[model samples]
Target: MSTDRFKDLPIHSYQSIRGDIQTGDLLLCSGSYPVSKIIKKVSKSRFSHVSLIFQWVDRLMILESVESYGVRIVPLSHYFSDYRNSGKPYKGNLYLARHSAVKDLVPNKLNAMLRRGADLTGQPYDIEEIVKILASVVIDDLTSIRNDKYICSEFVQECYKKAGLSFQDDGRGFIYPEHISKDPSVKPLYELIP
Candidate 1:
């Protein structure tokens, strides 16, 4: 929670503290587009997407499942300067976050979690899960998420489970960016906004 180091939202630059970010960190987005607005409205939450971070050699990359690309890895800088190759910053508030349990994980466990992320690359995005998530929220039903496909948040939840870190859903429902954000173990680090 000592995100003060980044000087809060509208961060001067992601590079200033880029070196401080580590694998197992997270990126939460409160997007501005129509689909993002729909997600926020349906879930009654500010954040519409969540991605897991991985430190790959000299670069920090993100593992996220998007409607167009499914599960893929992209340099962290992509969001700051070239989202979707648009030559513009991402269209929303981006918060850096971390899970306290991740720090305690052994290297093998951490690697396993990250390995799962890597293995999931190119997996198809689950549009059905998105509908199910929104429906679960509306009607208050507990639905089990399928393993063959993923929504952004579901992918993150699955990866963390490989490291033996549970968000403690207790089979209550689908995982959402808001649910991860509100978890006691997930600490806010900084916010970078375009």
Candidate 2:
């Protein structure tokens, strides 16, 4: 069997991207799809500070959450940015079966911790747990991501979205609610590695 032949096939389907599924094909899912015109407008606007921050936070959170689930977090920056700049939705979504077979280079410890926390908690795990876990790393990454603005912002935005908060950074730190130690309503992040 030649690998070339498989490259020509339509390897993805839409239904798989829209619901719970398990299969051998691994893929990445991003923020609320079918991005509304409002979201699109806000995402590209110059002064939509709230939306911009939210999107960045949501993206980073998704990246970490998914990575924790053991999936290889391919920044896929080139792919995503190319698609966004081209005004097209990303089409590589799929459902992967986390059997004891396939493997990738990304670590799975964070994913396991997330799963354990969820198990101890419940379907809608306490947002505080997620925030506490994420905030612990946010500052660390902020200090190291000086060369990658997109990624730094993405991380911050995802955490904000998952934690249901808003923020404004002064380059050195952030400004938001003082007593935000409480959790916010968020969906359970799924696992990707077996």
All candidates' lDDT scores? 0.84, 0.27
Model 2 residue runs over 4 Å out of place are: 1-10, 14-28, 33-94, 101-123, 138-194
**What does the lDDT read for residue 155 in candidate 2?**
35
Model 1 has a clash total of 0
Residue lDDT tens for model 2, 1-194: 11121123333333333244321122223234432222223323111111111012223212222212222223323233443456454443211222122123122432332243233221221234324324534444432222212222233233333323333433334321111111122111222221
RMSD of each: 3.2, 16.6
Clashes of each: 0, 9
State residue 17's C-alpha deviation in candidate 2, in Å: 12
TM-score of each: 0.90, 0.21
Highest lDDT scorer: 1
